[model samples]
Target: MFKLIAFDLDGTLTQHRSKLDQTNRKVLEELDKKYKLLMVGAGGCERIYNQLNCFPIDIIGYYGMQESVMNNGQLKIVRSDFYTVDKQYFIDATDKIREKFGYTDYAGDNVDFHETGAVTIPLLGKSAPIEEKVAFDPDRKKRAVMYPFVKSLFDGFNVFIGGSSSFDIVKERFNKYNALTAYMKEHGINENEVMYVGDDFGCGGNDEQIKTGGLNYTLIDDYRNLGNKLAFLL
Candidate 1:
């Protein structure tokens, strides 16, 4: 009964910042025959598209701030939204959190300001090694303890424990739930006809919004088991 199948990229489809393997790519090829496959991710549309090795699917990126579609065998951005952020405010606030949590010593920049007006506070610093970041909060327990406090500090932004060692902050109106709903409304598709697949649905997780928003979704705990988890869909 589903017409659309959306997905989260990083932890759901592949290892963090890794390429999509042939196994999952083949699974997607099978799914594409029966349903519209869309990529809904925390990163930008172009980044997701390339990571998938240009698998030929539409992408909703930056939690809905950007939308792109495949046209003529190439990805094209059809819609994009940007918001201005107070850089000083984010830097000061992140510093406060780092000091409180004893994460004051980091490798790179304290915060990452994206072109889309989104912000990220990398706990291990922006330039920290990938291995270190991955090990920093595998269970998200470290971020969970500080999630509430971070949210309190960034009242005007939607805060999520994103990636392995960072907090993703966006404007209040942007989130996977809102973005997916908007896509549904635009396409005249009913909510029940859509199924979202993702991994990060835990506390302060980026995909938490969609899960909590009551959407029909399949959780992927291990990317290696993605095909098995979604075998019923196939």
Candidate 2:
């Protein structure tokens, strides 16, 4: 009864920022024959495309801020949305959180301002080593404790516990739920006809909105088990 299968990239299909593995890739190949596949991710469309090694599937990126489709064997971004943020405001706001939480020291940059207007407040600094970031909050406990405070500080923006040690902020209108719904409306697919798969559905997690929004979804706790988690579909 399903016509589409959407997925989260990192943590669901592969390790964070890692390439798609052969097992999942083969699974996708099989699924593509029967249902449309989409990559709905927190990163940009192009980045997701390449990370998948250009696996020919439509992609919705930046939580709906961007859209891309396969064109002549290449992924072409067809739509992109950008918002202007008060840079100084974010800087000052993040500083306040850092000071209150005693995260006054960090490596690289305090916050990453993406071109799409999305913002990442890296708690350990953007340039921190991968190992350190991964070890900082594997269970998201630390981020959860501060999630509400971060949200309070950024009233107009949607805040999510992102990556290994950071918060991803975007406008309230954009999220995996809204993005998936918009795609369904455009393609004439019903809410019941699509299934989303992701790993992060915990509080403040990036995929929490979709799970809470009443969409049909399956959770993959470990990327290595993605094949088994979705075997029923195959």
Give per-residue CA lDDT, model 2, range 1-234, as digits (tens): 999999999889988777898988998999999999999999999899888998999999999999999999988999999998999999999999999999999999988999999999999999998888878988889989999999999887899888889999999999999999999999999999999999999888999999999999999998999989999998
lDDT of each: 0.93, 0.93
RMSD of each: 0.9, 1.0
- lDDT: worst 10-residue window of model 1: 131-140
Cα lDDT of model 1 by residue, 1-234, tens digit: 999999999889998888999999999999999999999999999999999999999999999999999999999999989879889999999999999989999998999999999998999899999888888888888899999999999886899999888899999999999999999999989989999999998778999989999999999998999999999997
lDDT of 2 at 94: 96
Off by over 4 Å in 1: none
Worst 10 residues of 2 by lDDT: 130-139
Q: What is the TM-score of each candidate against the true structure?
A: 0.98, 0.97
* Pairs that clash in candidate 1: none
Candidate 2, which segments miss by more than 4 Å at Cα?
A: none
